[model samples]
Target: MDNAATTKITENVLKAMLPYLRENYGNASAIYSLGQKSRAAIENSRIKIAENLKVKPSEIYFTSSGSESDNWVIKETLNPREKNHIISSKIEHPAILNSLKSVERFGNETSLISVDEEGFVNLDELSEKIKDNTKLISIMFANNEIGTIEPISEISKIAREKNILFHTDAVQAMGNVKFNLKDIDVDMLSISGHKLGAPKGIGILYIKEGVEISPFINGGEQERGMRASTENIASIVGIAKAIEDAYANMDENINYTSDLRDYTIEKLLNIDGIIFNGPIDNRLPGNINITLKDTKPQTMVQYLDMYDICVSSGSACAAGSINPSHVLRAIGRSEEDSLSTLRLSINHNNTKEECDYVVEKISEGMKKFKNR
Candidate 1:
């Protein structure tokens, strides 16, 4: 149920990566035939990924994770000395927010535009915030916790009109949304492999060709010198396979998960005090976040876990934190309501019977907690 947190690597993806991990083990940077084979595999995977994204092969740079990609774009894309202001939404992931905070030391200022009750960015405010010094706008394509897909194309347009660069952390939207960068003017985008059923270590940074940005990591010429460190060949192959699989079955997966999500939401909301969060109809297909009145998120999480039903209070990244979710706060949820929020992210493999079992357990927990 916690598919948003991380997905089980697809069996096909795993199999695709196995040869690279074993018989074909070679340093992609070396000059031997074995190494050349590894290099060829990496380039082939990159081409496949580029084809999936409908972008040129030269624009894609493989990174270690979405956070690194987000950080690279936030910290590297603009010159702090010249155009120093960056615009972003208040409900952005910590990867974007924390990167902005770090760049402040270099004299860059950040404007965090507030979102609406449904987690959509206030475009007027964003337009109003852009000044001569506003060099970049970095907003997420979707909210990981609340599952609200933002107005990405509109944001891209706003950035273009201002002649500023646009970047999106599309980590959560990769497999779930209809994301073809060719259709939008977004300057940069980020995606993580694990979110799409690949291994956790690989990610992609799609830098639109001609978008000028200096390299963040420098050493042993890798990622066309944009990023360093030896390539993880197996994981690269895994990501390509995972993405291919995800797109091939995307329509069916979306329909199945969307139906399961709606079913879960209906049953869960029937509980006396449950309040739905995020955009009801416009959210990510498999996401269901709700506030269970008077009940803490951790309590329900544990209660559900007892029955082998996995879910989350919020992002898996912020798993053990005691603080209220920043996303909920941005949408006007009180600290207490944020604390009581639960996220149930389903997938194609999940079924209505599973949702029913989860609902039964949740109802039992609510009653038990009410008594205590």
Candidate 2:
């Protein structure tokens, strides 16, 4: 299942975007009727996204992607305050962790909390890391590689208790899990549309009310000057429609996908020398990360590709790299285990027949590798 990286857009979302691309094209800022119509469509999208997130429309800032949103929030939150310390986990996506690297150049102090064997942040260590100078705490809602779901609400509580702002990169969790911004009490969150069967280049950053931060892209006063560009009207509408549909069907999707995931995992484990990674229970519904003890992940990925069974070695963004997964390393995996890891992320559209095909391909590949 390669769906964790991106999903095929739903028919309804595609239809929702067509008019804007064809007949309704207009600069949202113009005073003309077409412009007003475009502007209204953008506002409607904002309202729907805000309603789903349980936040005010004003708090939702449309962004280009999850990376841009993560970069914007981290840079803005840490730059304004004299306090330069930040708290994050070792297993955060490069969007957050790499952004933190740039923040450090501005003389900011950073505390990276270590994760346990399951890729979960140690809450006790997280509490110890926060200090008076710690202005922001950034963590991921779920890992892209292993699908380890973090304790965001618990971490948010800690950040609230210490009066520090908290942000979560919820790109992987948004459509797959039940989330309410109010319930988490987080100050900011980031999610990308492609993760939920919408188009790429569209995402949302939820900023808590009254949290003043600088804009990432400087231009005309769009997104209240927090982000500035002519609205991506069609994609924004598509995102809103996709999120609504995903949330509405979340329960059924979870049940179906989870069954597929379990079936695949059970079949894989029946083979010799296979080990699963991440928390068995506290993980995403359709994620199954496993390692064949002696085979390299890249080799297995290539073998599977030949059989038309797509999978990933780590994060899709990092798939081209020769380096082992940082998330696996953080969870105390050996180099051998890390090199062998393969991630299979399913979705509602995946079928049992597809699962059987993948298992057959994997078993065949492993047998060949063992012989060699």
Candidate 3:
């Protein structure tokens, strides 16, 4: 049920990556024939990813992780000399919020836009906050905790009219949601391989043509000089294959998972004091975030784990901190109520039996905790 945190690497992705790890193990930057083979493979993977996103290959720049991709766009797009203002939401991942903190250290200004009770960014507030100095606007494609999808196309239109650069942290939305960059006027988007069925340590940052931005990493002239590092060849190949597999099975997977999710939500609602978070409509198909009254999220999570069922209270990045979720707080949840939240993210591979089993454990735990 914790598919949002990460997913098991599919067999096809591993099969595609093995050759790069063993037989084709060569530096992509080198000039030798073996290195050329590695370089060609990397380009092929880039092309495939671009095709999936409906963008040119030049727009895709590989990075170490989704965090780095988010950091790169923020660091590269903000010109401290003139344009100092940035706009984002309060419900963003720490990657965006923490990077904005760094941007503030350099005397740049930022506006943390607020979201509504259902975790949707307040579009009117977002438009009102934009100023002439606002060089960039970064809103995530979806909420990781509550699974509310944002209005990226509408937001992009607003940014375009204002001539501001638009970006989306799409780490959670890439494979689960269907979108094409060519149809949207956004300037940049970020994706993480591990969020789908690929391994960790690989990500993508897509920048539109004619968008002038500085380089985040400076060295070796790699990633078309926008980012500098030796490419993780195996991981890169694996991610492309993972994405390919995802799109190939997108419809079936989404329908199946969404059906299971709806069924789970219906059953879980029967538990006393169970209140669902996020809007019922326009949310991610596989995500179900809810709070149980009179029970702490950590306590329920611990009890469920003992039953060999996995779920999370909030973002995995924010795990281990004994604090209320910032995302839930942004949506007007009380601190104590936020502590009672649990995020159950189903995946395509989960079955009705698994969903029922999870709901049984959750119901049992809620009853056990309430009596105590």
Candidate 4:
């Protein structure tokens, strides 16, 4: 149910990476035969990802994590030397929000556009927020906590009309949703491998052609000098294989997981004081967010963990924080409801039986907590 945090690496992806981790252990920068082989593998992975996104191979740049990708794109696009302003929504993942804060620290202005109660970014507010100095409009393809998919194409069109650079933190939507970069006119997008059943430490930033931004890391002339570092060949191979598998089985997996998610939602709704957050029709197929009016999510999460059933109160990155979810607040959930919210994000691996068991546990926890 915590697939949003990260996913277990698929066996096939691990198999594809084993050889590189052992026998082909060579730095991609070396001109030797073994190193050249590693370099070729890295380029191949980049091409594979680019093809899946319907973008040119040269546009793909790998990073250590989705957070790094988001940070780099924002930092590069918004130069602090100038009075550049950025526009983003209030419900974005912490990675994007924190990156914006970093720019804000350097005196770059930012406008966090409001969202509707359903968690969709207010396009009117966004359009109004853009100024002559607005350099970029960064929004997430989907909300991590509430499972709301944004109107990305519409947002892109607005950005294009206003001549502002657009970037989407698509870390949560890359594998779970089907999209083509050629069909959308965004300047840049970010994706994470771990969300798609690849290991952590491998992420991608897609920069459209002719969109010039400064280099992220400054060192050896790697990644065509845009990002300079020794590439992780094994993880790169794993991410490529994982993304390939994801697209290959996208329709089938989405249908199956959506059925499970709906079934779980139906059963959970039978409980008292159940409030479903986010739009039912415009949400990710695998995500279900709900709040029990009288219950705290952490209390239910602790009880669920006791049964060895994993779940999350909100973003796993904010696991220890007692603060109300920023996403719920954006959607107009009261502080009480925000504290009571639970995010159940499914994946293809989950089954109807497993969802039923989870619902049962939640019902039991509600009873136990109510009694207390």
Each prediction's TM-score against the native?
Answer: 0.98, 0.98, 0.98, 0.98
What's the lDDT for candidate 3? 0.91
Clashing pairs in model 4, backbone N/Cα/C closer than 3 A:
none
RMSD of each: 1.0, 1.1, 1.0, 1.0
For candidate 4, write residues 88-131 as lDDT tens digits.
99998888899889888888999999999999999999999999
Global lDDT of each candidate: 0.90, 0.90, 0.91, 0.90
Off by over 4 Å in 2: 80-83
lDDT of 1 at 134: 85
Candidate 3's residue-wise lDDT over 167-276, tens digit each?
A: 99999898888888988778999999999999999999999999988898889888998888898999999999998888888888888888889999999999898999
> Who is ahead in lDDT, 2 or 4?
4
Q: Lowest summed-lDDT stretch of 10 residues in model 3?
A: 75-84
Q: Residue 135's C-alpha lDDT in candidate 3? A: 91
Instruction: Supply the global lDDT for candidate 4.
Output: 0.90
- Kindly list the per-residue Cα lDDT of model 1 for residues 1-372, writing each as its tens digit: 899989989999999999999989999999999999899999999999999889998999999999999999998988745748999989998999999999888778899999999999999999999988888999999899999999899888888877999999999998898778988769999999999899998999999999999897999799889898999999999999998888889898988888888888989889998899999867899999999888877888888888998989999989999999999999999998998888988889888898899999999888878523
Q: Sort by lDDT, best first: what order?
A: 3, 1, 4, 2
